[model samples]
Target: MTTGRLLIVMNAGAGHSQAEASRAAIRAVLDAHGRAYQFFLADSGSALPQQAALAVQQALAEGGAVIAAGGDGTLNTVAQAVLPHSLPFGVLPLGTFNYFARAHGMPEDIKAATEALLSARIQPVQVGLLNERIFLVNASLGLYPTLLEDREAYKAQYGRSRLVALWAGLVTLWRARGRLRIVLEHDGQRSKLRTSMLFVGNNALQLAQLGLPSAQQVEQGALAALALRRTGLFTVLLLLLRGAIGQLHTADKVLHFTFQRISVRPRLPYGRRRIKVATDGEVGWMSSPLVFAVAPQPLLLLCPATMETPA
Candidate 1:
């Protein structure tokens, strides 16, 4: 394939120094290859430039690709704008955790990643949408979303330290184990459950070490739902331990199901209070009564030929 026009969208404020370094590396690669490209920067990664979508559209009009150079959230924003136009997308994996990029087998080495992008095979992947908002990885609620919000606060204070975010999550998990009443409908079954956390995955997660059944089984054509009913602190801790040790299993307290769509209404009135949510590590506060569905084959992702490989 020929090297085409590329537009690089970067989140300059995401990881501060780290983002800057990644930007420099990207520029170096572009210079080395003498490739034609355009650079656009967003201060906080929250505000999308009015011209961003147009720029990508213009690139695609001329048969080009747009590269997202931050974390998954950045990719989600860019994807929302570009995918509908059938524009090919690339990722630079410059966030604290590059889950989407890593999962897709993009290289972590900046130069090599750039080279891979220049020669990588492209595949169409399914993306999930929550009330029209696109999520590249998963749309989750309950404790995970709460923890995501908490993690954001720690990231603001401690920068991109994963340890800091993990510590903050642990603290929040211990103090506020708020139970959410959820009504889940899957496979023609409607059930009500009180749970501390509910995870609805766009794709199954690999849990090789955890002798438990693989969550990856849910990735086929439907959405995978995992709900935890246990509210006791000790029980929660034990579950966490099991997850850490890859020994967690689907049990009565933990309900796992797969479906084409789901609607979540919290029993507690959300009012003006927003529920926390994260899409590909881009954290935000959203209103309750969330609806999520699979947007099957919505994104054209650049992945390595060996799909199972991780960057």
Candidate 2:
């Protein structure tokens, strides 16, 4: 009952001029292949649910695959809808930071990427769950989320420039002051601490000790957590400098740890005043008492066969 067709879900407003060019090239490849695929556009990827349900149902009926043609957020939406049904998922990498695509060795060239998708191998990828919602990458809180929200506005005015984002983040961090209570339980020990930022990854990225030029693989059975404590302004500046140079290996105030499961409860009460949470650039505010757990092998992804090689 599987169709040979493909479903391409696009967020038309994801990236800049180059992203548009990539889209055109992808269209050409699909046309040349004579592939039966539909292009569904949504203004904001939040509207994906309406188009995704039907596209998924049709693709399932026809034995087709669903391809996410934008950024990580768009891909996350497609994954949310199709993962439970066991449909294969592919990425087109037409967004600002295509982490998933880069991690999987997907080509940045639109035509080449499409061609690779035609024959790419698939493997199960781990997903993380907070409450009932699933996150493909990592989820973060505290200063980082505020920075993301501010950067969105900044990008609106300055386009997708990393410099603008950096400036906005620095400004936000300067004015931000709050402590987040986190309780982490793993390896038979529980610790409670206050931090400026906390991040939990479905898979860990191995960088050259500089925290850059890193690679994140879908770990089949584990979860990773990072906790950043409050630091003096001078230390924060040093960390920023190292991060910019991609040499951020050690920051005395930053606590990086990995665990299979962790729980976080804000000392503050749950309300609109709650802290914001972010996952792969998507931002939202959440109330206190957030539970995070590993959803092992929750979804299947189409990736290059060579990715299975040991890193």
Candidate 2: segments with Cα more than 4 A from true spot: 1-3, 15-20, 203-220, 245-247, 270-274, 309-311
| Candidate 1 lDDT by residue in tens digits, 1-311 | 33678788887876678777877888788889888888777777666544357568767678878888876778788888887776778888776666678767887777778877877666777777776688876777778877887788887888767788778878887888578887765556677888888876664443333333534554455666667885687787777777777766744467666666887766666445567776666567677667778775567777766664211
**TM-score of model 1 relative to the true fold?**
0.88
What tens digits encode model 2's per-residue C-alpha lDDT throughout 216-301?
A: 32343655666667775566778878766756645566666555567777566554446678877788777656767876445767
Q: Model 2 RMSD to the real structure?
A: 3.2
Query: Residue 114 of model 2: what lDDT?
Result: 88
Pairs in steric clash, model 2: 2-62, 2-63, 3-62, 3-63
Best by lDDT: 1
**Candidate 1, after superposition: displacement of residue 254 in Å?**
1.6
